[model samples]
Target chain A: MADVEGAVLTARSRVEVDGWQEAIRASCQPLLEAEAIEERYVERCIEMVEDEGPYVVVAPGIALAHARPEDGVKRLCLSVVTLAAPVEFGHSENDPVDLVFAFGSPDSTQHVSLLRNLARALQADLADKLRTANTVEEVESLIQGIVQDVKED
Target chain B: MTTKGNPEKRLKVMTVCGVGMGSSLILRTTAEKALKQLGLEVDLEHVDVSSARSIDADVIIGQAMHTEEFEDAAPVVVTISDFTDVEALKGKLKEALEAQGWLT
Candidate 1:
């Protein structure tokens, strides 16, 4: 199983930009600015979204954006932004992604583990609560619940 | 007397991820099913992405982020979102193999 640290789920709670790239960048920029990840890594994450159209939606309402370590990843952080309204990705059952989780890992091996663990955790009802969260604290609480569950398990 | 009969060699594939479990294994199973439908016999293995460079296979499949590791080893690489979307992945595998002329 992948080692999952409790995500710092930021209460972005909405798409603040027009296009998908802009929205992802908006969601990711704060993490970069806080030194959670390097700036170049954000660009690569955006590129992955543009290239693949959000194939990382492991479950309903949750989408994980990531790329290779060489794309300039510096740290491991799970930054999140929930849209007030989900956005369209122009794919079947892929649109309306309410929760955007951006993962930045320096190693591909680590990333796969992370993806697996994350997918497992999100498969629960807590992920659904996260989708409908109205406040940042509510989102944080949901994330905390998952973190606790992960630890206990 | 010259021997002229030569059987076609089976294609080999490796689907790798962080661990040889979970989604990676799911992907491996999906790839195997797809290749079988394509009438290709494959030798498939599941390993960590770090060991991907050492694995000997004709194609390596994984998330797009890990593409660089297998860039030199696997002549055909298919990077998709996840292996859950069997139809989409089938299309991607077909495209990759056909591009490499590995498809009959």
Candidate 2:
């Protein structure tokens, strides 16, 4: 597994958004500021949800927002944004998402290791912890714990 | 080469999403774990839903939104609600495999 020490960026606090579109935009703001991805990437992600459906709501209370690397990814990065209140993404099984993860990958390979590690972490209590976390450090530590666990394994 | 009724014939499984880079990759990892537990070998790849229609594969795994677009593209289309739930994925995959006569 790749070391995820600096790969993750967390919002300073749980953000208040009007709906899923704003939720996705807020989630990708950190990546946009870091120059890891362009504005088009964020727009494309929203467009995808509009065109298709809420398939990004991969789990209950969680939304993983991403677009094609060709859309505008400058590097490989991930961001976490927790909502002050849950927003519905129209997903029947995993609606009312409070945690959103935005991913930016320049290519196909590097993100796989991070995602694989994330997949393991998500299966645990990480989502619940993230949703209820009060501080950015708390969210950071929660993600760091996942990275540390992967290293140990 | 293996003869008839052999389980060694590797199956091609594709995991798909709208953009293919994010959730599909995660689903691929989960599917790999599920297939390993079932003692099945598979050639798994992740693709966008748009490209998935033309890609040849024995089974296609994706969210309900995307899978409905390719119902006729593959012999088996498995709709997964939660990508992180490996047990659910395993059960769905096992049922699909058994229905296709790939598992007994």
Candidate 3:
């Protein structure tokens, strides 16, 4: 109940990056700019990918970036980043990721419920359509649909 | 009976990730489901990667690059590049646990 909710994003409509760090940094900009999270949280997310390899791709094209709240978190929020060209997160067998959803939660318990909703939204066929979307509006609409679904549930 | 072949008792497992929020949770869910299907009742813990070096668990599952960070702390470790396929994940984990005499 920190008054933080999910936001639909159009900022990551056309991100092209060489590495996983760049991809995470580029994608999480919207959340970082909105004061949705501490500045270091962005770096922490990138560091997670760098140190652990890319395990963010929960499903094809969609990747969720996160780290511990204790690292630096002021609010509970969600931001979406959709890449123009899918970038590799070091997972050799899986396809490159275009969607990077960043989360900033205040606690572990809050994170589980929030993440569960996002995962369910992304694992479905609807997320597949959003992955190949051509316009920012298309991406925004897809995120809107998912957020609404989460609210309803 | 533990699928790990250790009839003595089933092993407790933990999966740590960067923040224990996003990908880590997903991995935990997948891992728990996979272990259950194999008849292994693993106790999965979601710990932040930063503090993983301090937490105590029977076996730690996480990204390969981070294995070294917890190598000294955890007795058993299963570094996974991908958990998208549960069968492949179980196979790798089985091998690790078996080596520890926790699995058959």
lDDT against the true structure, each candidate: 0.62, 0.83, 0.67
Highest lDDT scorer: 2
Chain A TM-scores, one per candidate? 0.79, 0.91, 0.83
lDDT of 1 by residue, A78-109 (tens): 66777766766543444666677776665655
lDDT, candidate 3, A1-153, per-residue tens: 223244323345666777667777876677777776788988988887677667676655667787768878776767676666777776755558776778777676766655555555543455667667778777677766655665666
lDDT of 2 by residue, A1-153 (tens): 453554654554588999999999999998898888998999998998898788899887889998877889888788888888899999988998999998887777767777877888887667878877889888877866766766676
TM-score for each prediction?
0.57, 0.89, 0.69
Higher-lDDT candidate of 1 and 2: 2
Candidate 3 lDDT over B4-93, as tens digits, reads: 444565566778766666776766766776777667776677766777666777788876655657786776887775544566678887
What is the CAPRI rating of model 1's predicted complex? incorrect
Residue pairs in candidate 2 whose N, alpha carbon or C atoms collide under 3 angstroms: none
**RMSD for each of the candidates:** 8.5, 2.5, 4.5
Q: CAPRI band of model 2?
A: medium
Which one wins by lDDT: 1 or 3?
A: 3
RMSD of model 2, in Å?
A: 2.5
Evaluated on CA atoms against the true complex, candidate 3 attains a DockQ of 0.28
Q: Backbone clash tally for model 1?
A: 2
